[model samples]
Target: MLVMHTPPQHHIVILGAGFGGLRTALELEKRRARLKDFHVTLIDKRSEHVYTPLLYEVSTGALHDNQKFCVGELCSGVAVPLEAYPQAMRSKRLTFKRGEVTGIDPKKKEVHLKDGTRISYDDLVVALGSAVSTFGIPGVNEHALFMKCLADAFRVRQRLAEFLGAYVEGKEKRVEIVVGGAGPTGTETAAELGNFFDRLVKNGIIKRKDYEIRLVEAAPDILGIYPEKFRVHARARLETIGVILMTNTKILEVKKKQVVTDKGEINADVMIWSGGIRPLDVVKTFGLALDEKGWIPVEPSVLVKGQKDIWAIGDVAAFLDPKTGKRVPALAQATTKEASVVAENVTRRLERKRPMAFHPPSHWVTAIPLGGAYGLVDFGSWSLRGRLGYFVRKAADFFYFFSILPFGQAFRMWLKGTNVYIKND
Candidate 1:
């Protein structure tokens, strides 16, 4: 007589369809085919995932269609159906549920959704992500536009279009666009807007003297997290494209038509906020162990502290870098890397094996596109700028796309018409 053993099925619930959660589910789906004991369920509010890295480009006319950026279509372009992935095709246990996650009960291992339904899980992955932080600045939330989502990007394009149209029609003599914060999002957006205006002026649509672009930072210098060499290089590039740098100037308030700063007031037609971020509201209420900043504390295995089966990844999770003594950044690169670690650890635990610890990289790469066909790239010790840097950034964008999309689709989309640079007349 021969005896056989059957593996027990496990219910895995992943919250949020952002990069970290989605990647973890996909990675687990691959392993479940062999393990044959786990069913994965992914939940999110939106139907599509927004590719945030390209949002600045979409906001500017440089990457648009029909003279505007379509918020719905832009999100749909990047959003792939969670159920349509190859792993999902082979695994009937993989599924996607569209709903807003309201709360969680760790004692019962149940997740509550706004729809009044409850989901139970043997293992849970909480990649709830982060939200924009206005820092309680007076009039910011009410007046200033954000650049966090596809909808925000679309609103930016629409507002810019209206402002520029008025300027061209002679109703406005000067148009000023102020971008608050000197981080990558702010700097890139400022430079892109400068390039857009330069094209309009060269094409005789608007006079070069009729518009002003400002990049404001409360910090002493822009790109402060980067090396001094890269920061100076980035600053010079912005200046070359006619963006006025306002460093060490804090914003006091945002009025109806102007912004009051510590130094002076800026007359503005548009204002964009890309200042900082905080964990989502749900994360704050989840009762997870969080740091003073309210981000979930996670162990080196990417598991939420004090929780055996719950893992937290992405912006909502804070893992301190032992080497730098700083929390890992909320960049897309970090999200993907952390997702991989969590996925592996989850599998190892299922097999009764010791979970592996995550090691932060010694150094990271930074590639930024200034504006037009110009940009900068820093590869740890080495650096490059100008056209070469621009191409390098494009290559990195394509590489990320490749990781998420089918090869043919990624290649075609990367080379799409939206990416083509229009020559300035």
Candidate 2:
């Protein structure tokens, strides 16, 4: 008589709890009933997952409607705790580990943590996101502030508040803010800061002529990736709010109290960099096939080139979109969709089934808030401006938090009733 033995369980480890990693975990949870002997462990340096879209809002102190919320308050609730997944804990198949990843040994299929612990895996998913890239610019690393994480937003707010206090107390004559990049991050931040300063002037906290905000861009036009109409609208909106545009200007170096540009020099009290991002250093340690730009190159199926058991997603993965014939932009929509493909592929591979290729939308729809009650929306050729766009942006934000947060918490956050907002008398 022949006896049958169950094969050893496949241990799957995912690094980073950003959109890609979190969505992958949710997808795998649904397969708990079918995929026996399947284990998934998610690892993130920080236990909380940040909602990155609202980052600029926090920086500008416009994260609330009727009330005010501190930067820390906004970020504290926006970040969902990775370990708060009751469903995952109940299934006994998914677990969350908090630790910074030091390196990856592909030969041994192991991940080394900074805390001196090692995790072995049969399959690995790399979603560790990118960080601000200074492009070897002198003084950029030492002087400029970044807007990449929750902590960054808080720091910016703190500095702005300090500057405002100094100006109101007659210590400083003027406040000059210089923003670099002119992409969505830069545009949104500039708009928010302008609006915040306008409010200060209205409330008599500061004089109108006390602050000067400049947005510097290396490109000829701002929001260059968007349609021409949207770009025009964005420029007009920003100009109306008194944000000076320095197009086709490149920053040579950031100094202690000023930024030197190729065009000239501008004295500034604050310099925020939204310039660009590059893949994290740990990505190279995975021994994966990287593109010329040093980003992990993956197929439409989200599989690392030439490797079956290893996959890459999120900002770290460089995938050429077949429909558009361009590299997919690192957006929340792209990351979430890629995560689904990766999860499905992993399930199919484990069940001895063929994997499916990822098919992204040919065009993406996006809304850019222009501070206060104004925003702009772009859906291919069509566009919407003003309050309508603002509501749409709010609804989109609502759906995102709703999908990720508990029902009650999502409701409060969406309705302006969240404790995140502080009521000022």
Candidate 3:
């Protein structure tokens, strides 16, 4: 009789547990029964996965009923613990590892962690995401606050609270929060400050005139990527909230208390940068082709251009959308869809099946909350505005949490967030 031998189970490792990575994990977990030949390990520096859409909401403080959540409370609500994914926790093949990656040796198919541990993988997924881009602007790195993670949001709130207290004590005449971007995050953040400051005014904590939210943009219009109608509504809502719009104002430098712009210099008590993001430096060492922005260029199948078993997704992957003939935007909705492709492709390759192309929907539902009970949701061919739009926005948020979390937990989260957001008007 001929001697028989079994092949060792293949290992799949995913770096970063952001939207794409987490979604990919869930996708793989669902296919765990069929993926008996493989096992997946998700690695991240932080154990908790942040639900990023509500980030601006956390920054703006209590938007409804004049309530306020401390740094811990806000963070707890937005950041879901890795253990929350009960299905993934039950998957025998799926495992979570908490470690900061120090190096990647693609030739060896190994990932080096900071704690002197080395993990070898048969397949790798790089979804490490991106960080704020300062564009070599002087003082930006040293002076400006970023809004990338939970800690960053906490710091912003702390600084704003300190500024408010100083103003009330007559130590400062005015407190200016300069937001250096007009994208969805910056726009929503600036807009929502209306209700937060209004609550302060109502409580006699600070007068309306004591604080100013200055939203600066280098572009000619705010929400530059959205349709004109959406921009019009957003602009109208922002004006109603008393947010100062400084369009076509290029920030030459960011200082401790001032933002020097081509349009003029503005007095800033605090500068928050939501300007842009660039890929992490670790990708350069991955032996992958990086675009001009340092993002890894991936094929239509979402595989890293040069490697067979390596894939990249989310903010780190420069995936061109065939439908638009442009690179896909780094949105949570888009990332989840991309995760589906990566998961499916991995299994397909293993089974000697054909891989599918990366085709995302033309209209990923985007809801921009423009303060209070107002929001704008774009659904490709049509859009919704006002109360209905706000409802849809919250609903979209609901579905997202529901998709990743247990039904009961998902409902509780949605209820809590909706209750606070609905009463904002």
Candidate 4:
């Protein structure tokens, strides 16, 4: 008699528990029964996960700091809720290990962690997001503040607070703050700072005429990628709030209290670098097929080229637009859509089925808040401003947090009268 032996269970390992990782984990839980033949493990270097899109609000104190919750806490509850149906869910697993991944051996199908642990897997997902790219500019990394992470946001707030306190205590009659970049992040940050300073002045903490806020952009106008209507309205709103707009200005260098631009040098007590972001250095170590700028090169389905059973998503993965042949913009909407597609692909691949294709086109939407009772919303063709836009923006922010937080906890927080305001410790 001949006997057939069952194959060893498949293992799915995911790296970087950002939006992509969290969404994938939740999808896996929903498909637990069918995925019993496989084990899923999610790995991330950080203990907590933050929604990067709303980070600017945190920096500007529009939302409370506590709004960002740790990823581990979020996942643990999710895993438990799906504990039933053990027979159908043989290997549903999630692991949160805080260690940097050093290298990947595609030949052996294993990942080398910095802590000397070798994790073998049948399939792998790379969702590690990009880091701030200084473009080899001088004094950017060391001097200018970034808004990438929670710590970075808090640091910016602290720095701003310190500068304000120092100005109030000293005899200096003038204060200047320069924001580098006019993208969504930089523009939003500059607007918030402008409002913050205005409040301080009105509250007698500082004098209105003594503060100067300048928003510098290398392009001809702010909100370069946004629609023209948005650009016009945003610039107008910013100017109305007493923000000095400087377009077509290239930053040459950043000094302790001055910003050297191509046109001329400007004195500034605070300089923020919100220019751009590049792939993390760790991607280089993988030696994967990468774009000219070091971002992972992937196919339409978000799979790494020339590497089977390996995939990439989020800002770290560069997908070409089929129509224009240009790289897709790194936006939260794009990343979330990619995550959903990746989850579906993973499930199909495990079931010996074909993966779905990902086709993303350029789109435009905005909800830029210009401080209290003011905001601008541009939905590609139409624009709205003032109170209606402000409420829409607030609701949008609330919905993002509401979707992520567990239903019960979210409802409890709501019942407790927390109005989407995250307080920082």
Candidate 1 structure quality by residue, lDDT tens digits, 1-425? 11112237787888988888777876786677455677788888877666676777667644322454344444443445554653534557777878899898898788888888888888899987889887888988888898887678879978987776676577878888899998998888888888887777766777777889999999999988888999989989888778999999999898877999999999877899989898888877677888998999988899999999899999998898878878988888888888888888888887889998888887778788888878788787778999899888778877876777768776765665233333210
- Per-residue C-alpha lDDT of model 2 across residues 22-55, encoded as one tens digit per residue: 8888778777666667888889999778888777
lDDT of 4 by residue, 28-56 (tens): 66676776776666677775666665565
Backbone clash numbers for all candidates listed: 0, 0, 0, 6
Candidate models: Cα lDDT each: 0.79, 0.81, 0.81, 0.73
Which residue runs of candidate 4 sit more than 4 Å off their true CA positions?
A: 1-7, 62-92, 171-173, 361-364, 411-425
Supply the TM-score for candidate 1.
Answer: 0.92
The segments of candidate 2 whose C-alpha lies over 4 angstroms from its true place after superposition are: 1-7, 62-72, 86-91, 416-425
Better of 1 and 4 by lDDT: 1
- Span of ten consecutive residues with least summed lDDT in model 2: 416-425
- Pairs clashing within candidate 2: none
Q: Which 10 consecutive positions of candidate 3 have the poorest summed lDDT? A: 1-10
